[model samples]
Target: MESDKIIESILNDFNSFNIDDIPNIDLYMDQVTTYLNNKFEGSKRNDDDKLLTKTMINNYAKSRLLPPPEKKKYSKDHLILLMMIFYLKNIISINDIDTALSPLIKDYFNDGNNSLEEIFKLFIQYMKDTDDNQSIIDAYVKSNEYFSNLDNEDNKEYLQTLTLIATLTYECLSRKMIIEKLIDSLPKEENSKDKSDKNKSDKNKTDK
Candidate 1:
């Protein structure tokens, strides 16, 4: 099918940000946004869509999803974290992103021996290794086959579309469940610990 060919070709040439494209020197806000915008231009649903903006970056920093930039300039590690945030924001909440990645930032954000760059490279390699284009093709085939017994020509198109939407939604939700479970497994943040301590203190005071 034409869609099968298109999906295969697109997945075969799936693009991801290259680590080498990151400059050694730090970047100002404009440069960071421009670089990401250019790199992910093709992924935009609309031509005028902005993937990353200064306001969004600032908000991320404020929300602690991104580490603060040094002297208003972002480092390579900052870019790497932003890249991760960009990819995950579409699938998960910003708070969840922080829960999932804050530990990494605390432990390995600046660890030269265990850098975020190395992790990013490994993740990109994993995507390449796990490219399963056939599964997607099968999904489309299944969507097309749904409601084949329905003889109403007018309802057939709508029913097939509904089946496809349902199938995709199921797949997305199933994967989201796994991701949320992994996030749930991460160590509680210091703030959460502090809150727990505060609650315990309050309880003790009430008992006294």
Candidate 2:
């Protein structure tokens, strides 16, 4: 059997989460583990992990990454950071997770509670600038192209979103919706080349 040692080592980092920050696993580990296992596997080793020593825990309060506790008491926040490390090392290609986490950390510090809006917005910005999201989209499209089964065509959500876009599009062209805002929501000109492409969606909801 292939050893699960590497996987355990990577996961072992998350187990050191401060008990104070995360009261219980039920309170916090919602998407963190899912994000972790989705990114890290038992096998692949990239050059990046060379420096990502097991002696680390994400200390968001101090705005720093430091050595893990001796006994390894896990918390939800720490696990979230572990999930981020997995993404930085494997999925998303940014030099470090500390910088990648800064914006989210900044926003949470400002509000005392993290906002999903700011988090995803930062993610979108990163993906757009760093080719992360685009690569994921491309990979998904490629996967769909090759997979034998994917014909469960549900255009309801697609059509509804499209309807909203059409409404916005019609209004924009007719001088009702703001062109600048509509442009922000519209698909990129190059990406929108295939006008008939069903999967490509443009979303723009304007004030009526």
Candidate 3:
């Protein structure tokens, strides 16, 4: 499919789970994977495009991107965290994901007030209000059109690919800069101190 057509189709059918849409019951590893796959079915380009794998889940836990599951079952909060990591990892490093999500996990992991699910819902709604998908489609369409006009028929595909790459580069970098600023603005005494303590603990374990 042409890039513009693909973008239009994806935007037209863009769908994500609302807070209420997520399963409330604690799910085992396989179930969690299946649920996430189902939620992302519309976005997948092919059957091989798996959203979550057992190895990935284990790696997330090992890297502290996800809190450890209880008795091999993932709670609603864990699922939400995984969902956040899925999207953020596409544009940022795991370290950045840790920095961005640490405070939220600390404050609201299992607590009823200001829960992760609630925050996720708010973010989804905010994205919807901002018409982010439309913005993406417009950007892709504009870039594609701009590149199409150049008199290089032989290099048209290459130029179109470059245009998409340029668009993605700008979008990723712009968003990353804002995210870095936000991370820097977080309360240093709390987050920084916690990070230092964790590092010390890890080093001690390594030395042991």
lDDT of each: 0.80, 0.40, 0.80
Estimated TM-score for each candidate:
0.77, 0.29, 0.77
Off by over 4 Å in 2: 1-39, 42-53, 56-63, 66-72, 90-96, 109-112, 115-208
Better of 1 and 2 by lDDT: 1
lDDT score for residue 175 of model 3: 83
- lDDT minimum window of 10 residues, candidate 3: 187-196
In angstroms, how far off is 6's CA in candidate 2? 20
Where does the lowest 10-residue lDDT sum fall in candidate 1?
Answer: 1-10
TM-score of 2: 0.29
Q: Please give the lDDT score for candidate 1.
A: 0.80
Q: Clashing residue pairs, candidate 3?
A: none
Q: Tens digits of per-residue lDDT for model 1 on 1-113?
A: 24455555566545444679888889999999988887666667789888999999999887667878989999999988988888899899988988988778888886878
TM-score of model 1 vs. true structure? 0.77
Ranking by TM-score: 1, 3, 2
Q: Compared to the true structure, candidate 3 yields what TM-score?
A: 0.77
* Residue 206's lDDT in candidate 2: 32
